[model samples]
Target: MSQGKSLEHLKIVLTDIELATENFAEKYCIGSGGYGKVYKAQLEHFDSSNWSSKEGVNKYDLPKRRSTVAIKHIFNPEGKEGFITEIETLSSCKHDNIISLLGFCDEGPDHMILIYELASRGSLENYFESDDKMTYLTWVQRIKICLDIAHGLKYIHTNTDQDKQKIIHRDIKSANILLGDNWEAKIADFGLSKIHPADQEASTLNTHTIAGTNVYLDPEYKKYGRLNKKSDIYSFGVVLFEILTGRLAYDRIYTKVNKKGIAPIARHHFENGTLIEIIDHKIKEEAYGHVFALSKGPNKDSLDIFSEIAYRCLVETQAQRPTIDDVIHKLKKALQAQEKSQKENFKMSLEDIKSATQNFSDDNIVGRGSFGNVYKGVASHANGHTIIAAKRLDRRLFGHGETEYFRELDIPLKYKHENVIRLVGYCDDEIEKIILHEFASRGRLDGYLSDASLTWVMRLKICIDIASGLNFLHATDVNQEVVIHRDIKSSNILLFDDWKAKIAGFGLSLVCPVNKDIDYVIDDAAGTIGYSDPLYSKTHFLTKESDIFSLGAVLFDILCGKQSSIKLDDEHVFLPFLAKNRYQVGKLDELVFEGIKEQVDLQSFVTYARIAYQCLHHKRERRPKAGEVVIQLKRALEFKVS
Candidate 1:
């Protein structure tokens, strides 16, 4: 390691250290451990070429003092070897998460001290015991801290071109990790760490001693005296569970019953599907607070993915555990999910919304929704004036406990897509309940159904836009939950300038599993009477296919230039029934929208009618998925321009 070249410039005189630490006084010490007592002080460190007195402190002309630093005074023989090992380990390593070594004292027989960059926030162990710190550690912050530690561990585990040997930290725990002023974590106390030989092929080394914290020691390392890289991984896994449950591994809840600590208890809870029972209570409390509030707790999907990776690390078999790289990958996905839940958007003041809508005047009234009145307004922000549609729900009708209104508000906080209407902001101040969206210039799609100027080409494009948005809600490629928009009809679809259609009015959206297409949510049938699927009314099961049934009703309305149901002889008749009867009798064209049927290409009409027909199939199994519907609709559009 070229010890002479490295350690020569780092040597500091004992008297200068005494001045900084007050001669190892008790008041200067910040903390103490098995190694020694650590002190924090403002130490004087002159630039090499600035003052050439060959001494750090000059009585006649003092050098410029550096920032505050920590100094560890090694007092006993137990700490002597550790003092040398720390210098060897930290000198070769350089990373944001790993603490930096500033200087050392080795001249006198009584003093053996090492100085490091001070971490003001202290160790992670204090968070569990301190109330203010504990409250500050949100689920989002916890995930980020875990990522920082994992990245630092990965850097040491990786074999670099300059230094092929990997460094293994034998002791890893909350106490050994220090948090900086910005809440960034830095790993400390590398005295017990060991460097794996660069030339050796075998990862494990036969050691007579297994040294580490009692709770964090690797089971395999203790049983067989085999020291390997996976040993560090096992220890880090305990720290992961510690961050999740907000309990120290050495705490009596885990250590008193089983010295192995949180590994067994956490792993068992994860397997039994009761991991929520062990989650920090603070997180659960915040998750159920006012739903429309800006601050959102960790999402369910995010928690599931995080606990899954942490559980795999506790597997009894060493080979079954995930590698550091794999752990980092899963951790990234977990953080992404958490960020999606607490998305960065606006929290508009009530005054801002009132100003935009002119105090909810009659002139700005745009339309009506199930639980609210839509008002068109112009909101002022940093960019410019943005036209917005603010849907203000009547508190009396919602009763303050209805879940549907909150669910619609939750969408803006968790998900965003181009085909879906963008949520501008929301205001839930007192009785004023509002959800804002980008104003669609052309109003609702139903308002334009009978207008002949809405050409056949534009109609096909609108159909594709709706299908694409619905497909996004039900996409299964990622680990997100499926969104089965319970209400699908022409009134809920809004058109913007250039005929861009966006799916809106998600007050009745139901979230389900993507793989379980027919795995329904058992809720009372609640949708527009004419557009609702028949199966949902009978069985009270709202599923993805039920949404498809409603889509079919909308398609037929587009073709016939009318709503899904109309009056005949003073009684209502459904379009699906009338259209299916005509199709079977080879008379489907008899109901085409007047003046537009002649402009539509025959092949395009044939493609659209057939796909729309399959969507209304009596058997839900025969109905195509949202993805299939998109593909067929695109095929229909291609023939129109050909």
Candidate 2:
């Protein structure tokens, strides 16, 4: 074999490989990102005979499996270290909750490709912005996503082989968390990850690199450029806040005159019981639990658990914060306790309820939420005439936590309330867990407002009823627990045949902290779209004021019969004008709900409108409490209605 003969043979092989690569790239390309292009590919299963006794490598197989893999081909002509590092880190890590790396390809100096199991559902970030994606993941599915991420982080921090180097995922934003076909979360993007030497136990690793999303990055890490496991903790805190509140970590800023407040401001408000103010409107409605009676007022136990866990995990000083293992332990224990309590509190079976509701006929459905479908049914214990609302948890949907639901509802059911919806009981067997509540026959206030048959007086009466119930929830003593509705939206305000309103849903709700976080709450966001408080959405702050803002939005929605955010239909080009005016301005009444001009008294309506406006005030300090809203509404009712 002469040198020229060897060269000739190599050239022939290279030509064939190049042709195969080109075909793969062209046929399978799906999407492109910063590092490379992703393609959904189908490769033939490699047999020993195929590799050893092949006349030539076969490109196609006789039979194909109904499976696909995502191929990320990195086109780095210069052979970049950063690109190589990302691929290497991801390839080395192996966790059930992290996307699996099937293989890698070093086709040429200019091209490096990594193969991973395809995520049919795509990134979690898609769900927030794309209407299609939002429709796909329901509230229950979102909670599972959060749990998956937590499990993945716990594995990275503690469950790995002790002899091996510990892993730290530097980037843990929503965009980096991918969803599989079943909506299971898979933490992706390990480009900035580091392998901590097994022996070293420093809070800050002396890494000469700084990497993470701008808003999600921990303040200490940003200031000192120090890398550690706690950095991932801080990032996860922001992710949790985002999930609970359904808002970006830093969409809006809260400042005092000239001083710039820190990002994740919800952390500051966590201890102060004001963290609820920062939750996303969508999450507020969805995660918003039912109101329960306590010695002082209404209470939301589930949200209290969420806020405590999230706050501890996101403590400003890494030394004080719980490790991922600690966080998981606490959450698992709390969840288990809740599940056990729910099992003990209930007596009736799903079959009995199904039979009572005539096999869950469509006519029986009385209410609905982001996670579960609701049905109206009768119970045998309360004589045949007593009607109860059965909320059936939809397991198929993505976005909410069923475990949290059971945990939050048990205690509330044991204690009855006059103004709050009475939880008669709940049923959790194998297929589903459903809550049975005393039915509010008139349905939600949202429907009342939407129905033209309801006059201005009816709407006003509904408004007063909501304020009174909220007032009961907020008014408390020094020794009594303070109840925060957490979610105060039009839909949650249910009405009876006589139009008397009762506040429902206390699962995502929480009891107020005696000593609340002054700046922010670190829990995952939970609420509805259009009605969420902007302050709570950005910072995960769950203040009573936050509820006031949401309540105000609901009031505004009812009065206007339109969305709160004013839109200029004719001026489709208000970007320049809006930019100049700080995106504020444009008369509230004129811009929104233009249809309500002659239908309602403008004077009486204006007073309620003003109350709603004050609730939505951006500053947490400026917004009135729920009690205050009730008082003011009472005053308005006396003046306008009388």
Best-performing candidate as measured by lDDT: 1
Q: What is the C-alpha lDDT profile of model 1 across 1-642, one tens digit per residue?
A: 246544545566788888877787899988887656899886855333244444344333534435578998877776767778888888667676788787787765458888887887899889987656777777766776787788778777775754456788989889888886446677888888888867778877888988998788888888887877788788888888888888888778977878778889998899898988888777765532222344545688889888998888777667778998899889889988877665433567899899999999889999875676889999876446888989888777667535766777776445455577777778776677788888999988999889999889888899988887887676422234578788899998989998999888788887765335546757677788878999898888777888898888888888888888887689899987778787778798998999588878889988889888888898988898876677678778888987
Q: For model 2, how does the per-residue alpha-carbon lDDT over 1-642 read when each residue is reduced to its tens digit?
A: 122221111121223323434655666677776666787855422222113233343434322222256767677565355545655555445665887665455556655666566787788877766544464443334444666788788777664577666778888888888876446688887767776767876746765667778777766777777777788887887777666666555544433311322244766678677876875555444311232211121124545665577777677676777777776655554444434443354556777788768888999876666657889887664224567788887787423566556634653553234566767667776676777787888887766554667666666667777776665556422212356666677677788878787888776676654335423374876676556666677888767777777777777666666434436665443221222133146355453344445655656756666666777677877777665566566555655666
In order, the Cα lDDT scores of the candidates are 0.78, 0.61
Regions of candidate 2 where Cα sits further than 4 Å from its true position: 1-29, 44-66, 76-79, 135-140, 201-203, 250-263, 287-299, 333-642
Could you report the Cα RMSD, in angstroms, for every candidate shown? 22.8, 23.6
| lDDT score of residue 389 within candidate 1 | 88
For each candidate, how many residue pairs have backbone atoms clashing (under 3 Å)? 0, 74
| Candidate 2 residue 263 C-alpha distance from true site, Å | 4.1
Worst 10 residues of 1 by lDDT: 287-296
Q: Which stretches of model 1 miss by more than 4 angstroms?
A: 46-65, 287-296, 344-352, 355-642
| TM-score for each candidate, following the candidate numbering | 0.54, 0.47
